[model samples]
Target: MQKIIVGVLVATFSVNVLAWGQLGHRVTGAIAQQHLTAQAQAVVTALLPNEDLAEASTYPDEMRSSPEEFWQKEAGPFHYVTVPEGQTYAQVGAPEQGDGISALKMFTATMKDSKASQADKQLALRFIVHIIGDLHQPLHAGNGTDRGGNDVKVNFFWQDSNLHRVWDSELLGQRELSYTEWTARLNRKISQQDISAWSDIDPQVWVSESVKIRDEIYPQEEKISWDYLYNHLPQVQERLKMGGIRIATYLNALFK
Candidate 1:
């Protein structure tokens, strides 16, 4: 029983480390779905007949509990990349086991391969949706020092939490909005200029942007509250919007 409890805790921590929380992922997916070209939308429909991208976006993280080796081992590192301060991802490069950008490139090739099995394509599409969102979460582009801020403990609104969890969910949760509501609110703020600027699908550009934001986000105080939220929410919202646009841009290019 004690072993089982420990396993559960480990599994939970692994999941927490790998995602943008369900709401954030779903919001990005929904926004992406809206921006997808008709051809891309048709392809997505063929690949995922029953579920929307929002549902599909959470697939990788949701599978973290699986006993399979792929989920248990290989896939965890696909959610984030680490670049030490002052170094670019190009300088650090992907670890031999691979990182988010490497996994994304592999999956994208699978998605574009006409001979690939439907199961494989489905996995690729879901992962593409997810990794785009994951890369947008600034912490996912860790500084290679603090486990993406998971080690930085803080009291968030008097609740014991770490900086990673606060960024991953707590700050967004404070809005009291569902994923769709968040999507709706964010989508309105996206303009043609914003879309044009964010439409670049280069993962390196995404990582660089994230690394810059990640550096700026570390909190000074151990106690976090409205001031923190008020300061960072714009960055959070912008990242989500960019993630969504880039997902659409990528898929539209893929299926075009």
Candidate 2:
């Protein structure tokens, strides 16, 4: 009976995540490319045997939320990758904080955790790629509420959606392109310097940058209409392009 309930919850969360285009997963793929060094890229490229692509997806929860009602204690790998209290990713957490300064810290810890099995590490690496991408999106940092923009409702291209959903898919998914197609479309024209600059991995810097752009991306009004999105397509595309490149940069660092 306990197992059955756990399976049902996992199914629900998976559906919610997928309905959002698995934005975090898509970004992970982009970041994996960004972070892979040339040599690592070659390795990953080869690793991309058809089987690999077919099997790629985010990890499922190892242990479901227990206590029947403790949603906050569910403790997925994502929980550790988020911002801690009071301090932004740019500033170091107080000395008592356990390497809570950046998502990368969590990434490194999970990679080295004795408790995590080999499969867990693989899952961690995938999410590390994804979480890095998540960190880059300003709204994901949020202002201590709304689970980023997940709570902020709006109309995206005539569909009812929230600001978080818009950032998750409305923008990136608009082109209806595959990962390669989307990456190729955006990759050709970025200047080398710009790529180098955007690739910086400082969590504080990423957070700060996201906060600054947050307002521009999401206006205060709740019912953002089609005109709003149309007006912001350029901005939307820029974020997606940046997201793809920065993801590659972070992933490259890992393999290097």
- Pick the lDDT winner: 1
Alpha carbon lDDT of each predicted model: 0.89, 0.53
Please give the RMSD of candidate 1 to the true structure: 4.7
Q: Which numbered prediction scores highest in TM-score against the true structure?
A: 1
Residue 96, candidate 1: how far off, in angstroms?
0.7
Global Cα lDDT for candidate 1: 0.89
Model 2 weakest lDDT span, ten residues long: 53-62
Candidate 2 deviant stretches above 4 angstroms? 1-20, 31-35, 42-87, 90-103, 110-117
Model 1, 1-256: lDDT tens digits are: 8557534433443456856699999999999999999999999999899999999999998898899999987788788887889999999888766789999999999987889999999999999999999899999998766778888999999999999998888889999999999999999999999999998899999999999999998888999898999999888999999999999999999999
User: Any idea what lDDT model 2 has?
Assistant: 0.53
